[model samples]
Target chain A: MQTELSGQLGIERAVFGFTPFPAVAAAISRAGGFGVLGAVRYTAPDDLRRDLDWLDAHTGGRPYGLDVVMPAKKVEGVSEADVEAMIPEGHRRFVRDTLAAHGVPELADGEASGWRITGWMEQVARTQLDVALDYPIRLLANALGSPPADVVARAHDRDVLVAALAGSARHARKHQEAGIDIVVAQGYEAGGHTGEIATMVLTPEIVDAVDPLPVLAAGGIGSGRQVAAALTLGAQGVWLGSLWLTTTEADLHSSALTRKLLAAGSGDTVRSRALTGKPARQLRTAWTDAWDDPAGPGTLPMPLQGLLVAEALSRIQKYEAEPLLGTPVGQIVGRMTAERGVQEVLDDLTRGFEEAVDRINRIAGRSGPS
Target chain B: MQTELSGQLGIERAVFGFTPFPAVAAAISRAGGFGVLGAVRYTAPDDLRRDLDWLDAHTGGRPYGLDVVMPAKKVEGVSEADVEAMIPEGHRRFVRDTLAAHGVPELADGEASGWRITGWMEQVARTQLDVALDYPIRLLANALGSPPADVVARAHDRDVLVAALAGSARHARKHQEAGIDIVVAQGYEAGGHTGEIATMVLTPEIVDAVDPLPVLAAGGIGSGRQVAAALTLGAQGVWLGSLWLTTTEADLHSSALTRKLLAAGSGDTVRSRALTGKPARQLRTAWTDAWDDPAGPGTLPMPLQGLLVAEALSRIQKYEAEPLLGTPVGQIVGRMTAERGVQEVLDDLTRGFEEAVDRINRIAGRSGPS
Candidate 1:
């Protein structure tokens, strides 16, 4: 379906978000859909700059976006020591003991205390934003909060749209108030941090609450039928994350790739705060179960939580600990059965959109299911 | 869109489930869609018979269905006394003290023992089934588990359809293997007991899993656009429950109606095991919060949990405790802004369905958003 959205972004109905592979983004964009690189893990400004440089070289003349988390709340004006001090001793012990129990090697003394996480904080994200604006980026999306007004204005100067993810109508309204050009209504069934409401209800509410601003429906959507449904629910396009993990171009760890293709179903995921400070939908692994149990130490908030857990997870990833390695994924994982090329996935989505439209046309004619 | 489903049932796309008011079911059927009465509360066979009699008289020859819970797992061969004895003393105390703290009057001594919950058990459910079959019912739906082979055969003999509610693809497969006529894919966003997967992902999975068996998408679906989305996702029709609660014909207590219209939103409900032994989505209230808290006694299993909490809840309902009384509802509660007749609601659904088809047709034409 060639809506005004496609006319502007020069894409079909699909929009890929944080697909864990930069090459997939270029291919999706070349296939006539928006492809956004997830930047929360990029860490330093140069990391983003290097990725954008490579993306620029690969994509012919297609447009792409950059996504980074910049939450409104953080440990402001505090030293790394002060932030570390905020975590309780019990939580630290639980993390250490549990990883050890799983046969994960302990990091050398100074290694675990590497760089403290500032992903969601405005200051750290701004550096990523500055590097992002230097590229031929068509959009900039804040995954955790509204893009800062000044940053929004700067992106506007570059003719780049600024999108923000909202879990509710109230949050969407706040995004609109803060000058967001688009609202990605991510729901409970989505990977990463998600709100409690499901997409079916949340999309229409957000669409109605902020009528003028375009909305992209996300979460539990990974098919042509779902893309059609999102369009029916009044979204400008479908924003996807989890579906791309099993794509041929996806830069996934060998263990994660095998497990995703073999073991995951719609019910295999759980929304837990073990990986991130906030409740993010992820693969239900031994790590998540242990963190969720009563005897385990409770999770810390925001930056502190990331600082505590990411290292252990990185160690597990290195070892390819399949039972304990968890990745952010949605309920749509059940439908992602293979390692198809990105072009093939986009083609399927486009065909699904067309077939759905045809079916709907038949229904409107009072015959139905033609 | 009038299709095979509408032609078969002779109505618009909405299927009302457990609307509380028998008249609403009759009226919905009168408007042309099939209506199914939720028989979870009708513990006695005669009670179901009486309700169906009223429904049959009022529906003017329109077909309707009956839904009863018959979970696969139940306390086998246990007497009612034994089942009641199994509820932990702490759970019973928590139920009583918490309600008392909220100024709810305790049920008179021995009043709480009026009916032992045999909802999930076969014996109690068979009585309702027996009564249901005696009528001109078009369908019989098992709300919790796979319908028995004998029951499926019996329903087939009567030329009536046997449907089972499924929360996953595995459950849908089980229903199909059991010779179920239809599979109702009810997602987590639905009211009452539901699985963790959201409807958007669950509907398509169930549809694909039980290909020949028709699916009725349920949970977080109240509008015609949602109906269109469900159909697009490969459902025969949409199964609805929560949207009917605020209708003009609904027989809700005045205080509950007031709260539903004034206070409920997409985010105002929680999936907690407070009311049932399993997690059921209901309006969030102080009652649910207290039960969810770690300090409180954890929930008991199935009938035992129901035995512990239902009496206190019924007393709250009788007293019309607006702030504390929680009702089974979906996240779509946010769109339900006013009370209206069943016919008007159906009309809206029909119109929305047509408009959605038109919109999709426009997209298919590649003109988009006209």
Candidate 2:
């Protein structure tokens, strides 16, 4: 059934769901909200193109969006050759030794065993963006920072809406100045890289500071009441991440880790930089503990750190035995008690919103005029 | 300058600082650490008399203690008779009218006024305990929930050692089963009434659920070393409350309403009905908007609901302007960015402990590995 959001986005619910696994993008589009596919994990152009084609074919003419990570700052944007040269032999040896200490084996013989620091970095991300634009995608979003000016201009040339993630109001203002159509005010409680400000305070501050700009609240919001609270605080919609990680349809492969998350409480998580060299809230574990140790060499900058640990992470996933080797998830992971369909999750949000509205009304009921 | 805490109670570091004027107590105990005058505004019998007298006499003796309210649960055993009899009819009318209109007046005329709860409560609080027992006054403490059965019996019967405030862990395991030497774990984040549980996970979960006891870690500890992360996570010494209010010693009478706490990095305060049956935290004006809503049934329970209205509080203070009438305090209030007699406060705790140790440490700090 088409809904208010569907009219705005020209997307049908059924078509939206079969495409995106977590069904978040589909569920949102189905429920008249927009769904954007994250394109950070794909390292190859063909893999990203295949996913985009699948989404396009399955969406059944419904509009969808694509998200890419183009962080504003990196290791001073060293050229591919320069970054390759900067990777000292000792650092590479340390990475190998650390993995070996953890009982992880080296890559099979003849394989491209080591990934380069700048190898396929911007090029791959841009390729994904280009591929999505080639399809019927209506929106393009950047996670860590603003899309490069050319990317923004190219998306605009195609009449696609441009969005960017902002941790603070200042960041939001910059995104707006960059001709971005939407700003995702991701609070510290969010699953991915986040700023230290809380959603409760950050939402309104961003709304007021970036007046007249459409803002979406993202972070510890997993329930409908939280969504309602965000909207009440002036956000137009909510961009949820962790709520999808536990969905049965999500690409989550670790059953043991998923079970542990289902049983955890809201307090069990901590915001640590063991994952992406940025403060991302995740399930606290020995892996994060090692990074937090005062004696250990601190995490490196973004892409470099991600590159350093990607292979180790890949091995951790292959074994599926370590609790600390998973992708970063938000504090809301504590609320994922079961693996349900995305449709059910969307229904829950709707119900929660209605209930919150009712409660607020009850609380605001008065004996006299306002 | 070495006064005993109680009879045989050797005065240890003066750590108590919960008073309308903490500087005085902090000053008297200067070679030690600092002393706190318990509930400085309560209008009851044993209020300021004994403690002030002891403080005056022991000016050169050593540092002392002051205890006050930092209750976790508001009113539990309060009988209907107590509630009905204690609150005056005019005050009840004010509550009903305020609820009906979402507005509270600042003060009442002659007939409607007496000890309406704020300053008077502190006045009575200041009186109750005997400041002199035998040993020099070291630390003053307030029990939020029914004071330890033998606070007076043990402290007075023994002759030294001032007791202080507690919130949970079964109220410091019933203050170590009644003979509590020192136990205060206030967690509501300063200002009147607390208990939302946020001192970075309630200080080591009330310090390993009250092991050897002899612990003190109030809520919202605001500092870099703050008893250093060491004492708070678990330590034999650490007690702080409302140290952020006004501390010039010269600005004691300044408008309490004008006093403001500095912007604390951790904005995790919660308002609960631990003290007066209402939630309270030291935020700016936005708090009044939430608390003064007329649509709500005017806060419920003891000291609380009554304390919600600004006017009832104003009448109690009787100042021409709002006097910021409140009590207790939490470590979080240290955000009040002002500096004053730093030497005097530190000296009191140090000197008092040295003298107490000269007489006692045969067992103190020698209790095996922490």
Candidate 3:
């Protein structure tokens, strides 16, 4: 089911690729799929602008999208230092002790510092939206909840279709009421922030709850058969994130983390609040294990937890601390054993989709012997 | 794909209904699907024999199966009192306190008391199996791991197919090695004992791991569309448990529990060890919440926990404690909005399956205007 959204946007495949790297996003778009670049990493407007410029030159005129982590309720006038002060001293000490225990040294002088999730703040997302709207972006997707009403109106004025990620049917209904063009029903097996429901149950619920509005099935989807399953569940398309992390065009920055991801299985990932203080499915490492331990001080809420661990995580990455280093991923990681180009992944998805459809047709046509 | 087992067993539909009630099991078989009666509650051999006799008379010559809860490793000579002694005094006190806090009164004199999972003990299971084998049962499924080699050989001697439920491909492979005839890929969203892997990922992985072995997809499966998705993922059939609990034929003594289940959403269940030693999905209630709370004494392992909470759970059920009464249910509980007959559910599944297959074919045939 190439959704109405697909026809309206003039996209080819019913696959939606979500990545943080512009190169990967551009590559997926070129490969006849909709590519959405995650904007949470673009805390600096200049950096996002530079990447969007690259994407504009490299996308071969194919439609591409942008995903911003804009929380619906704005925390007005909250500065970084103000949020930083909210983190407990005990949590600060825990981060330091964890890094020291892992034998991870400090980042080298002049090296880039850790990345903060300050972009999730409403003001920062508004700034990112300002830069994105200036471009020819076809889709503006929100990673958190339904973007603020004014932001949706702004995207609409820029002629960009708006989509939002929802983990439940209740959330999907809210997104639909908030004037979202599409609902991405992200399940428990999804990489980043997710809910308790799995894809098989969540996809159909969201699709039914928000009728007429296109829904993209997310979480636990990596193969063509999965794409077919999504369609059978009434979703118009598939939204993928973890599947693109190992693509050749993507840059995870740490080879050790990359190697670990490649070697990991579906069972190797765990949903823990250790990352960003929200339950995110990620590679289960010593870092996650330490924080998940009952004896350790529990994780802080959202932005606070992200702030507390930012420097420690960067140090682990800088020192190549294999045991402590990890990345957010999903159960589909088991299928991502190799690092292929984005085009190859897209080709496999289409080919698999056809195979699954053919199989189902054959099964449907059969009249069993009485 | 109607597996070789389907033809060999003379089953009509690629649907496996798992229920503890022989009436429901017989009704499912009469409706052209395979029905497997769970033998865990049949602690007495006479009780099981009586049910098997009833199934034989009521099945209308349609073949049915029996599922036993035998652990792979035999715990030699451990009595109920011995296992009860293993539970800590603190845990016992906690159970007492939880029931009292909920104001659950004691069971009336001579009322059927709480059930101990001693049915899971190997010796008890062997007796249950002995009773089951007296009948012409076509399939013998183990709820835990694979049955012992001798048990497999005995079942093989009777020409009964041995199937085992597995949560991961690794466990599925182990079952294959242990002479399992079919593998049930039960995922994280399953009602009873389940693994971390969700059905969407687990079904295909298990299918790939145990190629040529008939695989039944379980967990998060309630609708015909989900059944189609299971087949698309390479499962030979769909194995469902929680879906049957709310059926008209089910005998869940408490109407309060049934009402709660019928009203629950997909988010209303949790994967908690509070029900049993191993993580099992159940309705989220005050009981589960209290057990899951950090302040309360943590749960005891398997039989210990089952033993500690049996009487308290019995008391809650006896008193119809609305807040404390809940049943083991999967995420699919959201779709079970009403109590329906076994035949009606079966018909809906087949019709839905056809609809899903037709939709998939149409989607596959579409060549998008590029």
Candidate 4:
């Protein structure tokens, strides 16, 4: 699976591990694969800077990347408070009523509720990008859509590869036109916001649509055999997100959520607009079920939905509300049976890739390498 | 990819081509891959017997299979007319309104509307099974669910293998325990009725759940690379349906529907319950959009939905209603760029499989075959 992307980055493995925790990112980098820190949770620029500082010291100078959530068209002059205020009162009441019915208690007075929508705002993403560029980041990835042309140029000026996650080949072509260095073909089974195309169908199409530009197959990839499959589908490598959620270094902060993810089967996840106002694949819980219910008030869009559910989600997480607890996860959550270190996961992936290669060789009527 | 299932059937390739036309099925068997003719459309036992006779003469003694849509539990004493009576009047009205609005012309007097619920009825399927068993069928596959245990035993008694389509590992396990010889892991991206899991995630889980029982990977598999990937994911072979729809041997009867299918991209399909009572992936047409609209009366459960729309669909196909004419297809319809012979498609698959194997071996740091 080694390709130009891996070669240019000087990464030992073609696997790209996406995580929000600097610890996990550093561990992944140290384990030879590329580590990409998701910058969405880092609402405070200093917090992201601090994490990058920590990563710089812990990564042993191995290459790592940073992923930001920036919408292409800037929603200028919109503050987080303005977005919060735009959320419908009915939606807010529905959130509260649903949580109360579930026996979830409110948070302590003056305690933070984890409601931070600024990270998604283009202005805040620019600030995060400023902080990320100060560090020796090798790749800059956008989660929502293609970043601005100037952002891509700025990254290119610093020799940083610009990458964007796309759910369709049309989106991939747009990213290619926008000068994206790599396209992450995120599928419908992916965690967080996803498109309708599944990885098996999307990867080959994106690869064909954006010829000469490399594509990293994402979603529903948790094992080495899948990595082999992704590469076989014409991907230069694999971009993984959910597999790192259960890693020992991941800072989930809630054992309840971790337990739910660990015990979830592929059938246990549902793509609902309950979270972040976009269709995200997550574990089936009361939260998803309540919002998806036709009788309940429907979810709001994007930033508003994120703001609407933030406090209630915080309360549910704080109280360990068993039935209401869940995090954004892909269908591959079914394969995450245990919590292991990043290095151990990497080892398993390498071994699995070897096994898949041998199996394919035998199936193709060729003798396996001695 | 010569697994025990393929070897037992004397198939030269592990590709299992699924089609409703006996011509396509016989052509597939003649091309060295296994052919499984869908028997749901064979509402009359004599029609199925006639097709089987044709296949026997055309296939040059090569093996072929039959797939029936029979419910696990018999709906005893329920006739097709009884099922039609169960459909709400509003659903019938909605179907009429949708087609009328789309300018789809109605069939003339004495014209058949193509509505036949008997094919799905248990009693009718039993008759089809009786006709199929009398032929030299090597495999008998059930599309809806597991065949009755006695049916499985009957097939086994005559040296026939029973195969069932499963969308989940749990369902695969159920099929395994029901004495099924092969489990077809049909993912969400598949044509017709399907489950929520994508092929990338469902294939491996079902393979693990039904170990030692040969698993065939279905859905979103149109290319040889996907066949290689399926084998790497532990599937014995690939079961393909959508790819056969555009084959020269297929009898679509309408060039408009075939054109719509050939021109579709991966994102051009939707999984909706408008066509049948069950959620089936099909091309996005005015018919699907009308039923999926929130303001509309929405789709009824399977059998009723099929009954309600059969006439309208028949009219659309008969008149070549440009916006309303569509067919059940998978995401792989994106690759159906041209109408070619089954032998050409099979040859391309073999070549693609070899290319994927070579690419994977090279990526694994091994030299390709001499």
Candidate with better TM-score, 1 vs 3: 3
- In model 4, which regions exceed 4 Å deviation? none
- Sort the predicted structures by TM-score, highest score first: 4, 3, 1, 2
Q: For candidate 1, list the clashing residue pairs, or say none.
A: A11-A32, B11-B32
lDDT of 4 by residue, A108-206 (tens): 889997746568888889999999999899999999888899999999999999999999988899999999989999998888889999889999999
Local error of candidate 3 at residue B81 (angstroms):
1.8
- Give the alpha carbon lDDT tens digit for every residue of A223-324 in model 2: 655555555555656777777777766766677677767886555677787676677778777566766775666666655566666666666656653645
Chain A TM-score, each candidate: 0.93, 0.87, 0.97, 0.98
> Whole-model lDDT, candidate 1?
0.80
B105 Cα displacement, candidate 2 (Å): 43
Give the candidate number with the greatest DockQ: 4
TM-score of each: 0.95, 0.55, 0.97, 0.98
- Which candidate ranks first by lDDT, i.e. highest? 4
Evaluation by DockQ, superior candidate among 2 and 4? 4
Over B1-370, each residue of candidate 1 has an lDDT whose tens digit, in order, gives 6556656656555454556568888988888777888877777788778889999998888888888887655556877678789888878888778877878876677664333455556778878888888898988888888988888898889988888999999999999999988899999999988999899999989988988778889998888888888888877788898888887887776657456654688899899988877999988888889888988887877777887776777787777666678777888888788888888988899888877776666665643334
Ranking by DockQ: 4, 1, 3, 2
Candidate with the larger lDDT of 2 and 3: 3
Query: Where's the lowest-lDDT run of ten residues in candidate 1 chain A?
Result: A112-121
What's the true lDDT of residue A130 in model 2? 66
lDDT for position B60 in model 2: 68
Give the higher-TM-score candidate: 2 or 3: 3
In candidate 4 chain B, what residue range of length 10 has the lowest lDDT sum? Answer: B112-121
